[model samples]
Target chain A: MAGFFCLLLVLPLFIQGFYASLLTMTFIYIIAAIGVNILTGFTGLVTVGHGGFFAIGAYTTALMGKYLGVSMLPGLFAGGITAGVVGFLLGIIFLRLSGAFLAIGTLGFAFAIGSILNNWSIFEGREGISLPHNSIAGLKFGDVGLYYFCAITMIFLILFANSLIKSSVGRAFTAVRDSERAAESSGINLRFYKTLSFTISAALTGMAGALFAHHTNYVSSETFGDSWLSVDFLVAVVVGGQASLAGSILGGAFVVLLPYYLSEYRDFAFILKGVVLILVLLFAPAGLSDLLGRLYRKILGKIVRGQSDVSCNLRD
Target chain B: MFAQQLMSGIATGSLYALTAVAIVLIFRNTRTINLAQGDFSMVGAFMALVFFQVLHLSLILAFVATLISVIVLAVLVELLVMRKIRNADWLTLFTATLGVYYILHGVSGWIWGRDTKSFPNIFSVTPVSIGGMLISEAHVINILIAGGIGLLLFLFFKYTRAGIAMRAITDDVEAAQLMGIPVKFVVTLTWAVGGFLAAFAGMLLAPIIYVSPGMMDTVLIKGYVGAVFGGLYSIPGAIVGSLMIGIAENIAGGYLGAQYKVTIAFVMIVLILAFRPRGLMGGQARREV
Candidate 1:
């Protein structure tokens, strides 16, 4: 809810196309990161195939809009549902694998998705898909409007995620993440929770992908190629702070915005980005959120100290 | 076509095995899945590409130079970048490698453009046909070289003092350290060996695939699949896993359309891991003391 309000205030400022595109990318990433965090950070499962569901959402939307002349409303929802199903199927079948093994397995699925997108002549291969513009509820979206649409969607998802975390189900997920043996001993269904987290994460990521397809009005195999896209999500989730919704947004922004700033420096910037990721991982396992929390406490302490000193002096 | 593709798969599987073994080596020692390993391979192949021109050497000489360069590159990274943070948490090591992944990727891209370049053939040009299919000479040579290296590595690890020290470190890092067995040096050497193997895979692979900064990106996933399927900690497992992946990939490509090839490989990995997280060979769970 706070993030939605934050978006409401900030969406108006990104009137330009480039910044709007950046915001769109940011939310797309935020969706993926949050989805990933659900699996890796919250539930202790690793998946690299969110990109597959992401591609599923993208292609479903693009194909619907392109061929069926469907409205963005239906196309977007269809995209998310399609990806959700894929995630669900994979979860039922392969969620048994945890750790890096699962990570690579899921990535293989992404690779398969990429190849299908590439070789199927109907999908347009490397040339890419052009999409119809989206509008809803008496409003035709310009760059800024669509940016807010994405932002609004992202905020809703984040709040929903927060709510889920607070519920009994959230504790179940945390329990499973900490230890399957213990969770099983405590009467929790380990298989069910693990699979459910993977499914839920897939659905969330698929939703992001659907929004992305509509937002870009363009899609291609390259859009979800290799670990570049997955790595971006990983970097955002890590840099922003895992296990926190705020961290997802901040990480998305940091990963996206930092690049735009670095593009100014050209080639050297790539090296710097890599270095930054490495350094952050090595030194800040708790991520930027911990740093901010520390800073917030320090500022509060100083203010409290000053106010108390004044009151004591007056009393004296 | 079946025979040729089978031979080619076997040959490439050798390269896959080499890469996966390197991954197994590092994972064996540190338990860190070094994503940077592939990028290191890219660096080696790129170094071979650049130095090939400057050294004015034959393809064999270029391969040797590339191997040496990448080994140094690996060792240096281990000593400077990885060693400093050895005691960091797991996520820290994983994330640090992501940094290493990009740093090498960016540096390689900056030095060499994103364009794909071809390499000179390190071996012959004729096709060898045991049956009706055509097996290229390069495939034959690649298989030979990979097999020879695997044997040497196997022997070295089994027989040499340095190799036993290395194995001891993987068995118990702190115990080895207490035994005054130079654990840090072994780790760096492991990275160097990893870098060397990845470079070898790249150098051999350059002729087979195009050379680019991201050339090994997809292959890295395949290698990971192989390593995990074999058991991350098991060398023999990696070898078997790579060959299985190669054969499966070929069969899938033939039976299913090439479009579904990647999907097949991925589905197989996912299926196997889900059923057997310990891999085909199984891994022992050991807690650090």
Candidate 2:
């Protein structure tokens, strides 16, 4: 684990330019996927419209930079806060809707955000918003610097999320997801936990969006506000392994790197993503994390006992 | 001007009604909100292009071919994708449909490219004077066809065993199974009918809005809003709600800005879901807890 962390820290040194940007994006997506997992995976509330929060975050950062000359750190926090507030309100409004209605309602939210962003002159419409230069405390980050920033933030967020998942609050979220009625009967306060989970998820995704804007140095409705952006986040969460923090890393890497690997047949990548999502849901409901865990256990067991005794599903 | 907007709104609403009905049909029975519903219609519109424009088939032949192909696609989706995870949780089912959505979207974009292609006009574009108000003949045909389809569906549901089975399943899955209603067959039939309606709506909408992979995005949202507005389980409510949405949006566009028109659907969803959780045409309210 120590060696893995070290290698991750120095990964940006080996890769430059395009590969560096890709890695940064992978980190950003992992952050967003973690947020998605908290809501969809842990909290049991699926949001097909997380792209709206992401847009809110990205735009918040971009617009703040453009008008207020706000630096990277402050802009990111502001973005997260703004998105969190929106998520809270939206959570309350959508509290009544569950199942298919909730999914469709969230989908509409993304579309609404997209159209609003598209036509709103403040967003600059199709032209988009560009930052002057993303800097923290007057220290501008180049590709390598940005990559390191994203990596550090991702690591920090992961640790924070891991702890969050282990806490009573996290337990409450899972309880709610497992059975809302049971949770309520047990005095879990479905309203409070659900709204709280949504707020945190939105904030985390917003922060990632802020990072994305800074990394790319641009924000536009075409890229950020598109409904596809929301879908991509959900893809990351599912592909990574819903409800698992480590899965977010795997899912994020998969989402970001798949297109790069399939650059030759770019369109094939989209179909492949859809196929993979369906296949994952059908066969591996636990996602890649479960597969990886099994593989690791099998290998470790073979090495330790000179036999394969892996009989049980670890998740169950 | 007001009358013209109203006429056009009804025409558009009629199409939305089709999509909403398709959505409600699938939702009511299977309890899966197929995100790929709109994409099925997209496939239909594109297939129509293939038969009519590419293969030089006659218009009537193309329409029939497109509907049949879409129905086949819908059934295949039900059997292959939906059936495997038939008893999964709502989140899992929703994600599966989303997967289908992406696959269809990617495949269509891959084949047709990103360009919006104009569909062959099924009705005359020239405005017809009715009571000193000008409305496109295409709009008139659209409304008529939508109404006719609604009537047919009403008859089928009211009389046919299969349709009755679908309603039974929607009401109670276990009870329907106990009654030996061939629940699986009815589910597949629902999907077929859903695909048919979606494709029909797409063909109707094709001439008005040029066909593209993403063309159904807004329509799907509005149709969903309409479905929710007219109780998710009620077919007639879906039709009525969609028609109202179409007219309301058109009026909003004409009086307010076009931007408001796009925003109205989202607002309506929140308002409807907030105020009347069961929708305008009342059905059993979905309670999560």
List lDDT for all candidates, in order: 0.78, 0.86
Model 1, A1-316: lDDT tens digits are 4545675657667467777877787877888789878877788776657778888888888888789887766776787778878887888777566666676777777777787788788788778889877877546787777777787787778888888877888889889878888999999988788878877888788788878888778888777655566667777777878777777777877877777887866557678888777666666767777567666666766778755543231100
Candidate 1 lDDT, B1-289, residue by residue in tens: 6666677778878888888999888877876778888888888878888888766787678778888888988888788778877876555677778788778888887888889989877687698775577878888888888999989998989999888999999788889999999888889889988987988888888877779988888678778878887678778888888887787787778877676656666666767777886687746645321
lDDT per residue (tens digit) for residues A103-172 in model 2: 6678888878888888889998789988978788989878888888888888888888989989999999
The candidate maximizing lDDT is 2
Question: What does the lDDT come to for candidate 1?
Answer: 0.78
DockQ of candidate 2 compared with the true complex: 0.67
- Write down the TM-score of every candidate: 0.92, 0.96
Q: Which consecutive 10 residues in model 2 chain B have the weakest lDDT in total?
A: B280-289
Error of 2 at A277 (Å): 1.3
Give the range of the ten consecutive residues with the poorest summed lDDT in model 1 chain A: A307-316
RMSD of each: 4.0, 2.1
